[model samples]
Target: MNHALAQAVRLAPVVEKVHGAHHPELTRVRELTQALADTTDDARIDGYYAELRAVTDNYTVPEDACEGFTSHYRALQESEQFWQNR
Candidate 1:
């Protein structure tokens, strides 16, 4: 498992325990992210990133990471959008 993927795995339980896993989109995202964290290659991460991107198309994650993976990914998404649209 990749180090970043390990972080992603840690993030998932935090997500579930604190935020519940009722939303399908987030459920899919978390599952994929868990898989993402379990992977051990570039191609695998890339593939999972695509799956995650698809699941996240219109979704905005809750801002309750208190400085963790969710916050980081959310910030990364917003930064990319800013750059992409700038």
Candidate 2:
């Protein structure tokens, strides 16, 4: 998750540069990414997951998910493992 957050921080500006600052999805990603990057506390991380759940309904991947969707969920699951060990 920390790595993902760092990547988000690194990529958001590039995304905005190409997609424009007003692009809503990228903007939201930036906000969430920044929030995650700003902390290492377990409680705070849990809170971020709460917020993410509110946004993504527990990261529900549909049955008909595309490759990207599957990869995203897989990454999140790995992130959870990483966080647990940290």
Candidate 3:
């Protein structure tokens, strides 16, 4: 995996804890990150990118969110940029 993806993976659990497992935002992030991490197929990768574009809108930090949550979103955004540039 690339560095941004790896960083997002490493930060995911902490973000989940901060945002709570049941949060919709966390669910999408976890699923997308895991899917990308687990797949090498081109079709699946294309699909993942489509979904990721939609999901990126949710990666913003809410006014009331914690520092860890903000960091998590930053990592995710970086990961998205990495993939988009590839």
By lDDT, the best candidate is 3
RMSD of each: 5.9, 4.9, 2.2
- Judged by TM-score, which candidate is best? 3
Arranged by TM-score, best first: 3, 1, 2
lDDT of 2 by residue, 1-86 (tens): 46744554666556545444343444554466567677877798777656655654565655654555445545444555566677
Predicted structure 3: clash tally:
0
Pairs that collide, model 3 = none
Write down the lDDT that model 1 would get.
0.56
Write model 1 residue lDDT over 14-54, tens digit each, in one string. Answer: 66555554544656666876665556576775676766677
Candidate 1 minimal-lDDT segment of 10 residues: 75-84
Residue pairs clashing in model 1 are 5-37
Give the runs in model 3 whose Cα sits over 4 Å from its true position: 56-58
lDDT of 3 by residue, 7-31 (tens): 7787777776767644556767777
TM, every model: 0.54, 0.50, 0.75
